[model samples]
Target: MYVLEGDKSAASRELLSRFTAPYYLLHGTDGKLGTGIRLLDCGDMMITMDVPTDFEKSLLRGKPAAVHP
Candidate 1:
């Protein structure tokens, strides 16, 4: 599971630290930076963003092929 947020990093970090699922993060130019700074108390998380317009293009790359989008 993952989230796309402009701000609220601290909150995200807090939640991510306790997240029970494998997760990813997509931090974007959503005009919320300060909140993001507080969310770094975590690992197994990184940011690689695809703006909503390009979502389908990113998902077509090769990965484990058993699942369908």
Candidate 2:
């Protein structure tokens, strides 16, 4: 799995389009509770959820690794 900041680039999209295996993209967004989790896509399969604020906190317990553009 790859954790990247910002939106997916055109090149990245193009590369994923050529893959036969499934791919999952998760994006963070602002919501009433706090940070919102968005399941961008899952190749042929599709799934989504609005992660609870508490759950988000648990998911990010450790110091985040800096993501360079």
Candidate 3:
């Protein structure tokens, strides 16, 4: 998970810390919102806590395979 906040909330920081997967805090010359949007636009997939359990399940399933010629 890549967070786009200049400052994270205490609860969000705690939650992210508990995750074994790598989480990044993005800051760029483009600014936080622009950076986040760019990441989302370029990213293969994105998951949010709207359904925490389901998101966890998807994460546990791991990254998808890439096909090559």
Q: After superposition, how far is residue 43 of candidate 2 from its true place, in Å?
A: 19
Kindly report which residue stretches of model 2 are placed more than 4 angstroms away from their true locations once superposed.
1-7, 21-69
Indicate which candidate wins on TM-score.
Answer: 3
User: Which candidate comes out best when scored by lDDT?
Assistant: 3
Cα-based lDDT for every prediction = 0.35, 0.34, 0.38
The TM-score, computed over Cα atoms with residue i paired to residue i, of candidate 2 is 0.22
lDDT of 2 by residue, 1-69 (tens): 222223344433443344334555543323332122222343432433332324323435764323221
Clashing pairs in 3: none
Candidate 3 local lDDT, 1-69, one digit each (tens)? 444333333443454566453564322222145554555578832532211223333444784322111
Report the number of clashing residue pairs per model: 2, 0, 0
CA shift of 17, model 2, Å: 0.6
Pitting candidate 1 against candidate 2, the one with the higher lDDT is 1
lDDT of 2 at 33: 26
Whichever of 1 and 3 has more lDDT, that candidate is 3
By lDDT rank, best first, the candidates go 3, 1, 2
Give candidate 1 regions above 4 Å deviation: 21-69
- The C-alpha TM-scores of every prediction are 0.23, 0.22, 0.37
